[model samples]
Target: MAGIGPLTQDWEPVVIRKKAPTAAAKKDEKAVNAARRMGADIDTIKKFNAATNKAASSSTSLNTKKLDDETENLTHERVPTELKKNIMQARMNKKLTQGQLAQMINEKPQIIQEYESGKAIPNQQIIVKLERALGVKLRGKK
Candidate 1:
């Protein structure tokens, strides 16, 4: 007992609270409550929520699948000669010079020319960007 020091007392638990909702969230809640009071049906709200959730889930799944497929297919796939010709023709039809089309696709004009002339095969990323910019499909099954 003489060698023993003072015993430490147990500490009380501390509770932390989160901050109140922001003004924007409060305003949104008020608007939603007003809409509900104005006879917006509960069933309609439920359906809208369900649809939004479904769309978000589906989009996430689709993007994940697309990314996985792209990663698995990184090996250079040959492009058809006809597709190259068609891509060139489409660019010409849009009255866009090679440089302009390259700018639109965020690529160099020489790369575009090489792709069109079948001198070089483009990576999948470039192909996707070109498809989006040109509004045409340049790659096919290999």
Candidate 2:
């Protein structure tokens, strides 16, 4: 009562106490104690843990066998040299540059370049688009 006035009052700061151990932590501690009572070597467990951590650290290493398999799976039949020549000739006859032809077909110029250079994998949809744009047979029997 003496610490309070019309415009003043006393306040105590809050104290934070340490939390009690969680159930999982208590269970792990009990297991460790039981293992010690059973004469299980703590040193061997420590060594095994260290070995596991070391193996995990080195697990980022690349497996070249899997990489080779992936690359092999990615292999595709490239556009034929004759097809490349025909595309170039047709584009030249139409007076359309690679960029222009790509624009006409709504494709990136790199696609046209890839087709002309014989490095493109044959896709039926793109081939059909190119045929319609260039008015030429680019695939199968011509």
Candidate 3:
């Protein structure tokens, strides 16, 4: 309802669908039918379906996943103390101020300061960004 468009248009008319498959899709359908006729079993069909669905879904999922992985703390976990020490040491070794390091990693200076002061532990992704920006390994690396 709140979008840049004609405010009163019926959505049904806006939704147009192709009744025919594209050439590539039609070729794929023929190949699948041929495989079926050649005695492709249920397991083979299932594998093909799974692979195709995964391929189709992955592209749309990438951007969403990138955003989620960057921002979401999936386990509600914090950076460990050892990692905090490493972050602070790394930032100091890099000869960068907290604000400068924050700018390098696209974070708030408060965030860098918090990590350095060990007052608040950052999320895993932020730890990774800091590690990369500061050229130091923080946590979970062998």
Candidate 1 overall Cα lDDT vs. reference? 0.79
Alpha carbon lDDT of residue 25, candidate 3? Answer: 74
> In model 1, how large is the Cα lDDT of residue 120?
70
TM-score per candidate, in order? 0.41, 0.54, 0.42
Q: In model 3, what lDDT does residue 110 have?
A: 93
- lDDT tens digits, residues 1-142, model 2? 7987688656988899998867997888888889999999765243465545667555544465556557446568999888898889989989999999999999999999999998898888888899999999976676
Model number with the top TM-score = 2
Between candidates 1 and 3, which one is better according to lDDT? 1
Highest-lDDT candidate: 2
lDDT per residue as tens, model 1, 1-142: 7999999997999899998868997887788888899988643233465545677788899998988778554556565688678778879878999999999988899988888887776577887887788787766642
How close to the true structure is residue 35 of candidate 1, measured as C-alpha lDDT? 89
Q: So what's the TM-score on candidate 2?
A: 0.54
After aligning candidate 3 to the native by TM-score, how far in Å is the CA of 42 from where it should be? 71
Off by over 4 Å in 2: 1-47, 50-52, 55-77
TM-score of 3: 0.42
Q: Where is model 3 poorest over a 10-residue stretch in terms of lDDT?
A: 42-51
Writing each residue's lDDT as its tens digit, candidate 3 over 27-134 gives 887888888899886333434555456777778899888887796456644556887788878877888898999999998999988886677746878877887887
- Backbone clash pairs in model 2 (N, Cα, C under 3 Å; residues 3+ apart or in different chains), count: 0
